[model samples]
Target: MTTLFHNLAAWVVAWAHTPYASVALALLAFAESSFFPIPPDVLLISLALIQPRHSFAYAIVCTAFSVLGGMVGYAIGRYGGRPLLERFMSSAKIHAVESYYRRYDVWAVGLAGFTPIPYKVFTISAGTFLLDFKRFILASFVGRGGRFFLVAALFYFFGEPIADFVNKSLNMLSVAFAALLVGGFALIHRLSKRYGQGSARPHSERIREP
Candidate 1:
């Protein structure tokens, strides 16, 4: 697994110099949403560091393709069902994902998207569990967009001086960013409750675990 990850990282980095770098990024974003193991950030971060001015553009491409790819993942779950999901992920893992859906509903997608969690798991599980399609898309859009844009913004604004820091601390940066997002969400939920705006989510949204 480590060897394959290193090889894939190298392959993704090599594309940064080519004319098709953005295309590769888009493809990586797409594939990773479903089947690919490596995240598009490997390429996004590489390309952005080399060409900071185009960071947001790269982020837009990554987000768009990732959401499109997520739809395909949803289709996989909708059509392929539990049997197909079992082939890619273990039953225990699948059940855990389903449990998240039961608890957080569509927001589970947002959490998975913004964090280091394997998005493919939530994407496929969203389908197998028959989550609302529109909500799934919305959550994916926000979560994926937030993450890619946040990564891009750093290199885009800070330039070369921060390159080493970003490279060394990217994982920690992502974790901190995700924690902030989660905190913001919790705060909003709390505010809504305090203001009496916290209406109960529809029961259907909380699909029971299979």
Candidate 2:
């Protein structure tokens, strides 16, 4: 598994230097926001590190495609995608998604977008719960943009030094970043629970009117 991951990472790094790199990054970003398991950041970081001159452009492309993918997930949820849930997800997964959406509203989507959480889950849940489209787009833009841009800037400005640091501390950094992402979700979850006491609605009950 470790060897496979290392080889995959090496391939991604090499791909970043090719013209196809941008295309792959865009697709990865899109999938990351939908149902894909891998985060786009890995590609974004690799591309930015390889070509610092176009870092910001890559960030923008990543952000735009990711938001578009999020909208697709949301649409699925909003328009009878709930039935498909049983096809793709387990009952336990569906229940957890419903619980989160009920408690946090659209902010849950934003939290997932920015953090290490699987963003597709929140996107689907948001649509399932009939969240406001305008608010959903706004949250997706802010959260996804903030994360990608921050990463792009870091790699753009301090490529080698940061690369060395990451190489030396990859394991620690991964754990720390994962913890931070979880902490962000935990904080939002607490706040949402507090706020939801008054008027929270479950996913199954949040159908939009025609």
Candidate 3:
């Protein structure tokens, strides 16, 4: 897995150095926010490191296209619903995400946008639940912009060193992200359990009802 990501990251860096890098980056960001698993951070970092002066521009493109792609995911969930979600993700995964929507709502969208827990899930869930459009857009913008621009800033200033660090720590980052995902699920479960217990009636009350 490490080798695969290293190779992929290398490919992204090399590709970002080409003349058509901007278009490619835009497309990549768009796809990632909708269906693609690979984040645009790879290309954003590479392009920024290579052309530090253009880092902000790279971030802008990433943020814009990513949000646009999120809209596509929203449309899919809104129009296609669970059938479409099942085509990509499992029913259980979708259910967990739905619970998250019930618990966190719009903030969940922002968290997914900036985190490695798969923004696509939240984007689709937003539409699935028919969340307020304006709030969703606002959350996406803030989250995506903050994340992409932070990457750009790091690359723009630290340059090659930061890129090298990210490349080397890719595996660690994945593990950390996974840990976070598990933690989130555990928290949700705990909350649900508590809520269930609190909402339950006493045994005497149940007998009286009968």
Clashes per model (N, Cα, C within 3 A): 0, 0, 0
The estimated TM-scores of all candidates read 0.88, 0.71, 0.74
Arranged by TM-score, best first = 1, 3, 2
Error of 3 at 126 (Å): 1.3
Model 2: pairs clashing at backbone N, Cα or C within 3 Å: none
Model 2 error, position 67 (Å): 0.2
Which pairs clash (backbone N, Cα, C closer than 3 Å) in model 3?
none
**What lDDT, from 0 to 1, does candidate 3 have?**
0.81
Provide the lDDT at 11 for model 1. 92
Expressed as tens digits, the lDDT of each residue in 15-121 for candidate 1 is 99999999999999999999899998889989998999999999999999999999999999999999999998887898889888898899889878988898888
Reference-based TM-score, model 2: 0.71
* Local accuracy of candidate 2 as per-residue lDDT tens digits, 1-210: 788767766665676778799998888889767676667877887777777778899999999999999998888778856786567678898898788678767766766677667788888778877899999999899778877786777678887568666445544554465457668879998988977863577755767656
Candidate 1 clash pair list? none
CA lDDT of each candidate?
Answer: 0.89, 0.78, 0.81
Q: Write the per-residue lDDT of candidate 3 for residues 61-125, one digit (tens) a residue.
A: 99999999999989888998877888888888988888888886776787677766788888987
Ranking by lDDT: 1, 3, 2
Ten consecutive residues with minimal summed lDDT in candidate 2?
A: 166-175
Model 2, residue 198: distance off in Å is: 22
Candidate 1 wrongly placed segments (more than 4 Å): 197-210
